[model samples]
Structure formats: C-alpha cells, structure tokens
Target: MIVDANVRFEALSALLGTKITSLSGGNPWKAAPALSVDDFFIQLILNKKTSYAEEFFIDEKEFFDPGYDFDFTNLSDSAACMRGNEPYVRPKGWYRMALKVRGKYLDGDAWLGTNGWRSYSVPGEWPVSYHGTGLEGARGIIRTHYKAGDGQQFGRGIYSTPKLNEAEKYCKTFKSKFTGKTYKVIMQNRIKPEKRQIIGNYWLIPVLAGTSAEEEKRIAESSIRPYGVLIKEM
Candidate 1:
C-alpha cells in the first residue's frame, strides 16, 4: 500500500529536527510534480541548511510485535551475513522496525574533506556500514558524534562492518524496565571510500601507523558518519 506523503515527510522532519520543504512546493506523491526516490534522496543529501541530515523512516511492513521471528533464508549477502555460532540469532532475523537516517553530506567537512571528492555522489552512493553500539552510545552519536577508542583492534578508529552479522556481534543488549523486553541497537553509517581501511572483513578509519592519540581521533571522526539507527527487539 502507498503510504501517506505528509505522514512520511512529517516523521522524517521531526526526527531530523528540520523542516523539509517539498521540491515542487507540493506533495509529489499526490500528483502534479512527481519526485522520484533518487531526487528525494539527492535533495536531502545536498541541502545546505543541515550538517547532519533531515530524513528518517519507519518501515510499517516490518513486524514489530514481540516474539516474531523473521526468516532470512532468502536474503542476499550484502543485506545479511549469516554465521553459525553459539547464542545464534540468525543474521537479520528480527524485523526492522524504524530506520532513522537521511542523506546529508557536506563538502570540506571533517567527514569528507574537499580532496578527491566526487561531485556527483550523493549519500546513497556511499558504501553502507553498520556500527553496533549501546542504546546510549547510539544517542550520543546521533546528537553529537561517534566516540572512538571502543574496539581499536586494528587501530584507533570507530569500528564498523560492511556485514550486518559482523556488527551484530558487537551489539550490547539491555532489558527495558518498563517493557521487560531486551533490545539491541545498531548504527548504520556511510563510510568515506578513501578514509576507510579494510582489515579482514571489517572497516575502520585509517589511523596512520604511528599517529598520536589526538590525530587518530580526528581521523576516526572524519572517516565515518552515522546515518541510521537500527533497533531490534529480543
């Protein structure tokens, strides 16, 4: 079913804390001016009013009721990474409730500086990465910035993975006192191609061989930016 345009737009605007005006000055989904998904994503990525972003969405189609198990047998490798291990919750087995993220990338910013920049690239062009973080940590990254030095296994940058299953391994679960339901949080990010370093199935900001602590922090923060928060109920 087609979702209401106003409902979608308002939900996004409120989450991102900014007003998102229609490109055609009217609801494109309604008629006259049809805004394609590409155009809609481009507008948010290039809009100069915000440094973070102005888009987010809740997938109504995904089940949110408790104890619902999702089947992942048909998912592609890029969508979910399956693994066999103890405490096994099949990769991407939970329904994706809400994904809060928008396309926003500013040139000459800490995340993507002016060098070797792609003028034609929008946020959608960037590679998708997942960062498993605590609920509180996710909040801090969304409101402010991602704090590095968490799992500096391969260096000193914020750790993330191209595989959702890899990220799931790092997620910390918490039981809500109010609902008695346990949940895990994961932050979805877009990594700068040149700024990230690959090391055996994981992606991290390249903290040069012998860089000082301060420099590593700078690189880590600039190399990756969180765009969405993925929540799963257990």
Candidate 2:
C-alpha cells in the first residue's frame, strides 16, 4: 500500500475549451494561451493553480470529522459555490449542464462525482476549474483537519477546507484519512518563485490511495490496504 514516490502529477488550465498555452518570455508564465494544446508544464508555472500543479506536493495536516456527508452551512450559497475564502459562481449554463448529468455530490467531497468522472471545481462545472483529479486534486483541503478530533462528529461525511501557503508551509504538513495518511506540497521543478504562477491555481488535490511509509509492511497488510475494501490481501 505504500505510495510509490515515483508517482507523478500533471494538469490543464481548462477543460472542453481547447486548453492551450504559449511560452513567451524568460519568465515561463509570460506565455500566452494557445489552441487545443495540452501542456502538463503550464500547470507548474501558474501560481493560480493548486500546489500539486507545480510538480511538488506539500505535506498537509490530517483532519477529523464524525459526520461524513456534511456541508459548510456558513456560506449563503450552495455547497458547490465556495472554496476556501473565495466564492465562485458557476456560469448559469454550466450549473444547468451539471444538473443535467445529475451528478451526485459527496458529503464534503470537493467536486461532483459524475458517473465516476471525478472532478473538484471552485465554482463547480463545465468549464471545470480543477487542480487535477483524484488525490492530486484533494491535497489542499486535506491540510485543514490534520489532527482534528479523533472521532466522528455527527454524520457520515467530513466538513472542512484548507488555507494558503508558499509550498514551505504545506511541504511539511500531513493529513490523516480514514484509509491512510496523505501529505502534499509543491513538486520539485515548480518550487522556484517565478514558476509559482501555476502553483497558486487552487484546486482540491486528494490523497490518491496508498500507504504511509512509516508503517510496517506487515502492519499495512494486516490493518488494511484500502480501508473501505474489506477482507485481507497479501
């Protein structure tokens, strides 16, 4: 269950709009948008993206919550409109489109899990603002509740969100999950200040499935490989 550190990450600025970028000045970000080009590296240069976008993952803090399918009641808007401190409004058309798909929203899950096409969006929709997908997309929020209450609070879902950082902060944080511990931060090449443009892009990177390096192999085998999947495997 140990995560292969060798695992890598990549991203696109937008989906379904011919996502493309141009490499302009000495500064990687001076680049402009091109046409239908898929540049995994653009995600690293833009500070507007999530930390995992830049190729490095900062370790985050583990969180806790008794309820599994909870919602952040403070916001005056629906669950999909809020991310961190920013309130994004999905274009009316996109919102309607998502509804057409009838995607099911997980309790505190960052995005719409539509027919297994998993995605986490700030505003949530067709234009699809995502750091990446799966674990890479859920990293930031994972830092929010690390070491939170040891037990559940009320329902079946987790309730939380994460703050911001310059890689250094999250680089050392760790998040505990029902399955295992997930840590994230900026990747190597994207750590330089100038290349941070894409790192700033905010998308919820999740803890892709894996085991903690610190645990004994046998312990991992006995305790669980993936917590939800019952039975033993060796």
Candidate 3:
C-alpha cells in the first residue's frame, strides 16, 4: 500500500469544465444562471440536472434536509478555537452539501445501522476529520473509495487532519472560467477511532508498517467515510 514519494498531486482545474461538458453534451454550467461557488461544487457532485437538483441524494435516496446553515452546537472546544483563531476559516460556516455514503463492511455498523445517516454527530462513533483535495479527488471519493496511493506522507493511507486550517493547507486551488474565481474543496470525513493512527497533525487510517497490501486496503475502505463536502472560495 506504499506509494512513491516522488508522486505529485496534479491540479484538476484544467479539466473541470471539459468533463462536465462531455457528461452533459456541452458546458451546461455556462448556459445556467449565476451561482455561488458552493452551489457549483454541489451541482457537480450530485451529477443531476442543474434546473432542479438542489436536494442532496445519499445512496439514491432523497433526503428532505435543504439549505445550508452555520452549526454552532455540538462542536468541541478545540474546533471552536481553530475556527475562531483562523482569519479565513469561519466558525459558523455551513455545510452546503451533505454526502453520506455507506462503505464496505458498514452494513452492520452499530452507530450507522441503528440511527441511520442522520446520526452523523452522535457520540460513540467515528470522529470527524477533514481531507483537503481537488475536484478530481472529491469526485473519486464520492463515486467510489479513496485510493491508498493518493497519500504517501504517512505510509500510504488516506490523509486527513482534525484542524480545518491544517487540512486547508493541502487544498488544491482551481480557477473557474465560468465564475472567473478560484475555489477549493474539503471532504468532511469520519475516521474510525480504533483503526486510525495520529502522527502529529496527520490522521492515517491504517497502520501499514508490517501489514499485507490487502489488509491495508480493507482497513482504509471501512475506517473512513465522508459525510459532507465543504467548499471555500479563495
């Protein structure tokens, strides 16, 4: 599960519009009305018609919750401090899109199975972490699972951070021709407490020092799950 240290993360800004065009038989975004950066990313991820695709669909089921709002409750003290101290990061930021996907070995999960996707913040489950990535990376994760080789800093596992500022450091910038502005995406994930190892600021899903390749992959697929997508305009 190890990746070469020389590998570089390519910026996907150049391909965003092209990909959308192919999927939609043209650059539908251009013909559509003006939208904020938040709505743009949400539309891309949902992969639905822009005219009436405001609701977020989890596992093909429509969830009634709509609109974005700042969540001030249920946040830990450290979360508050990081958001408060950071200049660009807002403590009262809203999650415009909710992405709750069930991964392998999660059918029988105690927390998720009992309370369902709505119980994302319930205690005694996986803790929250943020993984900053480009639009391509976000697409891959939402469509499938995380590729172990995508991250190699801490030995080939999904990389994330508890602090938003730290995660923001890894966020790749994309200049949108449609909006004439730049945007960044951060995946709000839940890391299994028992399967993850914290080394300084990075949180890695698998302990891959002496494990087989298959084992490392399994731990990664089951341990980390993305529940939300957070985007910021830079």
Number of the top candidate by lDDT? 3
Runs in model 2 with CA error above 4 Å? 5-38, 47-166, 170-179, 190-234
Error of 2 at 22 (Å): 25
Provide the global lDDT of candidate 1 against the true structure.
Answer: 0.42
| Candidate 2: tens digits of C-alpha lDDT, residues 1-234 | 222222111111221112222232233332333221112222222112322222222111111111221212222444454322244332221101011112112222222223221224332322222121122332332211223244422211111222222222333222323234443322211011111111223322222224332332222122111100001011
Better of 1 and 3 by lDDT: 3
Ranking by lDDT: 3, 1, 2
The whole-model C-alpha lDDT of candidate 3 against the native structure comes to 0.43
lDDT of 1 by residue, 195-226 (tens): 76666566656444566545544454456654
TM-scores, all candidates, are: 0.43, 0.17, 0.50
Tell me the TM-score of model 1.
0.43
Candidate 1 pairs with clashing backbones = none
Candidate 3 Cα misplacement greater than 4 A, ranges: 1-95, 102-105, 108-121, 134-154, 207-216
Better of 1 and 3 by TM-score: 3
Question: What is the C-alpha local distance difference test score of each model?
Answer: 0.42, 0.22, 0.43
